[model samples]
Target: MKKQFFYIVLMGLVAPLASCNDFLDMEPMSEITPEDYYQTVDQVEEFTNQLYADILTTHGSYSSTFEIDKDTDNQPSTETPGNKYDNTGQWKVSMDNSSWSWTNIRNVNYGIEVITENYENGTITGDETSLKQYLGELHFLRAYAYFSMLQKWGDLPILTQAFNDDEATLVEASKRSPRNEVARFILKDLDLAAKYMTPDFETSHTRISQDCAYLMKSRVALFEGSWLTNFKDTPFVPNGNGWPGTAKDYNKDYQFPAGGIDQEAQFFFQEAVKSAELVAEKYKNSLTRNTGITPQSVSDVNDYFYMFGDDDMSTYPDVLLWREYNKGLGITNHLEVIVQGGYDVTRSMVDCFLMEDGRPVYNSSIPYDDQTIAKARSNRDPRLVAFMKQPGQINYFINEDYPADHARKDEAFPPLDVGDGTVNRSLTGYRIRKGGSFDKARCDQWNSYTGSIVFRATEALLNYIEAEYMLTRNIQAGHILEYWKLIREAAGFTGAAADPQTTNTYTSIDKEKADWGAYTAGKLLTDVTLYNIRRERRCELMAEGLRWMDLIRWRALDQMCKTPYHVEGFRLWDVMQNEYDLEPADYDGGNDAFVTPPSRGQYIIAYENIQEKSNLYRDGLHWMMAHYLEPLPIKQFLLTSSDHADVELSPLYQNPYWPLVADSPAEQ
Candidate 1:
């Protein structure tokens, strides 16, 4: 079943589990009962197969983890891209969260109940290991669904068993559990998954494995721990000050599992460290290495350069799981064009990288010029060089007999002075090369078969480093130190041994203000050590579809409450503007402009170049307390609002500063 990843199994699963309309899609499915259907290991495999494809499918609408991760600080686009992050007013109370409903969880829960009972009661029979692996896959998928829900809406109902449509039963299950409890529940499921699943299940790299379970658990725990620690005494936490949950009877005095916020945070951080270290240890010998070669040096091969682009990701053991698309099967994606032109990797993100001498770029004596793309990437972490695309670098570094693909021009910097359909242009001058390929077959539109990495072991080490620091305040010691070195070395640093202390000591907020990593929850971090720990994670996982989660948990936008943060790209005015057809003054068209004004700053301001007068982020991107957690749509409350005039008694509470009124913005 895992080998069937590249094909059309996703659309053809007869289980009606796509989004179970009722508790378990109670509509007839060939008139098969749980007992009758759960007769073989093959049935179990079919039941849970689509979950792998559907659960984490499209990490974002971009269809690639390495994307122009807009909305967050890392990748900002013009036309007020996802204005919710810029102005709270852009966020109206959703009418319904029906799209992210419990249907997926219910489907997974139904599978769990049936499979466990059938296996235990002899209703199903198969090779013991195979059956357990299938069951474990179900558990893993359920945890993944709940974890995603936790990020969107903090407190989620920890549903373990499938329920009937009894009105009282359904409503009771709708009660949102405290986020920490949900995190713990997710961890428990992951443990069950790991216990039954082995590393590289069925010796296939595409399937859910024990190591993948560990990596995911670490990520989930790190998120909860960080959220708890940062939003400690705020209304965001379960029993924090002015919490909306406290107004409800069920959560009036919500006692945390570890007695209090601080202890509970520590508990989660410990879980993160423990689980992360397990995978970190497992993959200590197998992490990918950077060969210090860019895509331009196609003649001289670099394993790191080709890892993401390679369709056969199975060769890369560090990649725990990747979605393999087959060109023969007519299943492919247009990733090369996106990465070739690149995601709008923020100017601040580029500045965040440290010098090769184990020192902050601001303080290091290394020539720190950022006017050109070459200057910005020079003398910095090798991860920057390996990933950032430059102009004149050939897109077709491999087979070029295809004249159509060969005729494609070398990457050109996009006209920042313009707006509207930026098909294959770099919004920020800095283009991404991480998941890019030069292979002729993958170069064409919608014909790319570059495997999308689902989980990488590098993140487990990163999770361990940050969670340990958050818990113990000691990074660069013991396994933390070892993991830090491993990441730095793999990133092609090729310099002094990895030292977080030296880097932290030199990381000045005033000198490096472009980097929002130094700030947490609107306040500038005085704890430079903690800042550096976060810096490592930021560098390692850039453009990997994890920035939003990291920012939300860090409460990184809190400072935006006091001052809006204008997201900027490379210095277009100083050097690159001459390369384009337009100039600063020429960008004066009220609506038809394609470039940002140079008068604003040296760098290209992403949101300021928009044509729309209604653009909320024309000035700068702002934030709200409620923006961290999505507003629980009104329809959810209305569903249980019956019999309880006060909606608070309806088993759900509006998040933080958001009101119950439909279409209302965050009150804060």
Candidate 2:
């Protein structure tokens, strides 16, 4: 059935491709000499434009990895009916090996190699310093691709040049490099690129800037260092790369490959701290801060979160890197998949946050039932209110209930305007409002239509806070508090500017202090602050494609999956379909087509407590392996070196050294 669907979709796309070619064939294109191609600044400008397009094509909205990895934005309903596969319920498989492969690497290398060769051969000459700058941009882009590769597949073949089909076929079976080696290579490229790139956003969204290179380096170094040092128990080794049959190389490797878990942790943490500090200091002007007049109302709502909203861009005080959503080049549409029922906010994450006094609400000290939970939720972080709308709150569009489908939309629609129902509201009793638009004239029914793709300075600050808190508890406490203060101030919390819609719980104070020292290495900030940081991350980055990676790195999928599942609630008065005198045509919205109900009068919104055997929390871990990693193409594995049979495994299929299982092989 899935195969049939794939073929049908693929076939449907052919007509558009044919139409595109027809138009392109008639358009007269410019002919250029090698000298003219990179000669003047104008040609260089065009090259940068093409580079941006490349980045967008590979890493932008269309990136499957990004979509699959982040559990926040779900797969389109058209793609996954009933939203069953979307919750990432399936196990990892080796399908689409070509899609997961490092095919893009060669193209990036080719572009860089060509640009660099031209500059070196004196085919294109300008200010020698600026020429190096152009070269730096290319290097940064190439480095970016490799960094992405290392993250996806810990150790992979580091192909430096573009390979022809013949060359690819002729080359001896290559072994994967160690992750550490890949990290070192990436850093070297980034550092070299930094020298030539300028720290500006003027050229194009795709061009490499110094700040962007630094930003990328900091993020890469932090994740690599943190994950390697911390993930010791798993198949992952801390200091060295995972390539088969090679002594760890520290210099050529990312770090000095000598330390054990603790030693590596300290080293990586130190690097993360240093890199984060550099980006923070250098890009102070790029921070996202609220410029609104109501200081108090907006102080706790980070400008960074709002930066994605159309009206909030000019207010971002610190925006270092951003992708352009251009209508001019016919790339205006931002393809994002948003679930109407708060599908991204897993039940587990909802339970993880503490009450206003920084005490876990789930603890025995508090009541575990609905009433207490509702009251406790009020006293929590200000960002929570910014992100979710509770049962009774009014926003742009009042989400009456968490209905399962459009069938409930018709049932919930009241003859006299009032409310949907009492029991069927959001389970957390909340709906998302962050990415929502405030344009009274336009209502946001389809997601991709909202705001821009923004990268803010708050993320840099948050990264620093996480690194620092992990390293030292006492000394970094003050710094962590300072960063939080900045975040709060910028988010619009305080006296007069306080939003009327903001959670009253922001003002609710907790008098008692609960113990978290035992759970978090005795770090003061590690307890409440850690959860707050995560909450902030969720609130700010929700539906922006960061949740899944956060879950993986934190290894919290097991906990997150346990979160409650609730559809928008709809009140049911009867079971008969004919009572309303409605026909099938009256029920069709065309927007929500996959969803249906058990009967006509029954509201599909409320989560009927059906005793299903499957549990989200227990099953969540399976998604990590299945959706996060794509298996190595079986055909490619067959082409591997005979001596290194184990190397054929894809990270998704199993760890590199695991014995191959026939049922789990890519062929199956």
Candidate 3:
């Protein structure tokens, strides 16, 4: 079924390129010449679809490892020597690696240029509505590409057009714009895209729609606003101390396009609220619910579970955009298989989930050391049960090839036991079950066709709440309380039903105190409302590739460096190890094997432990403020240096605290 759909879309995409052979095969200089092509709206739409296939596909979304969520505070990876971002001291400047490339920007700008020029000249002889819609998609793609660049490299060279191959023109275009100015430019494109985009939702949820644009606007605005607010005193943000961005001589005293930084933040935050409100109001019913265990619904326990693992998300109205994978089309990923205990879930994440009674897990009567798996998970948020692989839970059924000896039977999984000397086991005993399909046939396969969600209305709701809370700093605001109620109700909070009036009981003040990421360590969050809001986001969006970005925008990593914070796993040595055979002969003696003479009470520790058993970070996790923004490649400076003979300094400035080296060891 998905194959047919892929072929249908592929045919639509291929037809335009096939028809415009002459235009496509034109000289490199005249390849994007508007007069040559851009004749029909169908062709324009087809061209825009290429952008979706190229830039927005799931293939482009994933990093080298499918598990991008690993190595964070919430999720720990199996491999030692934690992710480069976590290793602050070892990080160094590279000569070639950077996000300054313009390949995608050129593609998007070329499409926009062709559409704008052709539409203005009255050359596009097709349905104006279709042309406008495609134009909207191009603008959205351009904004998305620019935002991606802005996130990696603070300031960027804002280019709305394809540049010629002339060296002089290329050199002039390399000037970096202010981060705030770049953000405003992205918002400008989003506004245009939203203006021209079709108002109706796309049933496929794969294409860029008005809602997607609005969602992205909210995301971009909130990211910039939060970055400015959190790191206002640092050089990472615009108008901050040691900021290197300079306006051209003509605009020496260039004012912020929005206003002063504070006012600018408010403007963006308001925009976030406005756009997110539109999505929440429009798709309020699309939110997935955790309808409690019913006789008829017993087969599919949680709607939220299948929302991530299902082959199709067309039924979920909240999903604004998703990438559909088809095995027959040779477009599939192993995410479904990987989520099943492949990437380890950390204890920190497990503790984040609120109790079923809307209280923190720590606030329960059971002591920390005495809490069993069942005790820890008991009366917790339904999402925890739905998303995590609990002890002794039946995950899937295994069918026997020979029926004479055996019949198909359900596989009862054991508790999170990592020191078991198994390769596929979780590094941290806790494992992720969020994206795993319950069906054995699907879960067992390598490349399952389960769709990946790109944008969902749940994110918009969270965005609106956070943006509003940030702007007003009033958690008990009428609208804020209402949205919180909606989210908790949909999530199947136990207290949600009784608390119709939306009282503060559901907001556990005690739970806020127990939150590890809050107030303690380096985090300065003091307000319970603010802490709870962040907690909601952390719980709802766990292992969704959003944690890293959240930490960056919130500037939360500084807290990790303040203390000897350890990335701890389950109580493997203390209790979980007993679940497996302890004999020395049972071990494989591989690098992933349990430490010899396994030390008691020492789970996977971030820093070196006295037992020398499970230490991934021997040197300890140290974070430098300079790591907040990646350094520009030194090769860029060298190239610019060649343009001038007498200058000892390069034309561009390196990111603050990042020493510019002429050359360095190539990235492995």
Which candidate tops TM-score?
A: 1
Sequence-dependent TM-score of model 3: 0.84
Relative to the true structure, how large is the alpha-carbon lDDT of every model? 0.74, 0.43, 0.64
Q: How many residue pairs clash in each candidate?
A: 9, 46, 2
Ordered from best to worst TM-score, the candidate numbers read 1, 3, 2
| RMSD per model, one decimal | 5.0, 10.5, 7.3
**Cα displacement (Å) at residue 46, model 3:** 2.8
Give the range of the ten consecutive residues with the poorest summed lDDT in model 1. Answer: 1-10
Better of 2 and 3 by lDDT: 3
Candidates' TM-scores?
A: 0.92, 0.65, 0.84
Model 1 scores what on Cα lDDT? 0.74
Q: Candidates 1 and 3: which is better by TM-score?
A: 1
Angstrom error at residue 134, model 1: 1.2
What C-alpha root-mean-square deviation, in Å, does candidate 3 show against the real structure? Answer: 7.3
Candidate 1 local Cα displacement, residue 124, angstroms:
1.9
RMSD of 1: 5.0
Off by over 4 Å in 1: 1-31, 58-62, 403-409, 417-423, 583-585, 610-612, 644-649
Candidate 3 lDDT, tens digit per residue, 1-668?
A: 11110010101111113333533234222354455667888778777877876666353543212366666777766555444544434567876664556656766777787679889989888888778888998999889888878877787777776544344555555666778789989999999999998887356777779999999999998888888887776777666776655423422455676677888888888888998888888877657986532111235566777787677977788878877777788676666555544456666787877766666565543333413455545566777766665555655433223221111123223323344443364445566566655544544345566787888788888899889988998876636777777777777874643232322334554554323446432566766667777878888887777777777788776755555455666655556566666655433333434432244245554333322334435434556567777778766666555344322244456676676674432121
Model 3 misplacement above 4 A = 1-36, 57-66, 81-88, 246-254, 292-298, 365-372, 397-423, 443-446, 496-521, 583-603, 606-616, 642-649, 663-668
